[model samples]
Target: MYLDMPIDRATPHVVRESVDAVRRWEPRCEVVRVIPSITESRETIRVQWRLADGVIRETEVPR
Candidate 1:
């Protein structure tokens, strides 16, 4: 369960929570870095992860 955070603190908070969820669900993947961006009309989260096989990949939410 998640609660809505204020805009000013939302980005980082959301990113942290999301990363934690991923780690809990996928133990074989390592979360490298999380980038959160907000524009006038959009909010995006870019997550970079390293898999157990050593392949790195990135994904953006709400693309």
Candidate 2:
């Protein structure tokens, strides 16, 4: 996805797709939220989740 694009145009869809991909690939985790931090110079997608064993994790994925 292009980070240079406006947030409203691409960020939401990218956030959803990224969340789906992570949940699909990592079945052991449940996706809590996917947030797009457009306020930053480098756009970052934050994926938050809880594992089957109750471990919480939040990862920052650069666009």
Candidate 3:
């Protein structure tokens, strides 16, 4: 991760990394959201998505 990268550029990269991490490890779920913290000292990623069974799940990822 590049600390100098702008938020717009970094956001998608982080989201992609998040989706890839989940997809590669778990195929039973689909990612619907990947959000970065608006105000935090450290980067915090919040992920939300739906599973194959149509259940929605959400979790926070510390990057």
Which structure among the candidates has the greatest TM-score?
1
Question: For each candidate, what is the lDDT?
Answer: 0.79, 0.81, 0.80
Instruction: Give TM-scores for every candidate, taking all chains together and pairing residue i with residue i.
Output: 0.79, 0.78, 0.71
Higher-scoring candidate on lDDT, 1 or 3: 3
Per-residue lDDT of model 2, residues 1-63, tens digit only: 555787668877898788789878988889988878876456788888998788878999877
Give lDDT tens digits, candidate 3, residues 1-63: 656886666777887888999999988879888888845546779989898788878999775
Q: What's the distance in Å from true for residue 20, model 2?
A: 1.3
Over 4 Å off in model 2, which ranges? 1-4
Q: Is candidate 1 or candidate 2 better by TM-score?
A: 1
Which residue pairs in candidate 2 have backbone atoms (N, alpha carbon, C) closer than 3 angstroms, thus clashing? none
| Candidate 2 displacement at residue 41 in angstroms | 5.6
TM-score of 1: 0.79
**lDDT winner among the candidates?**
2
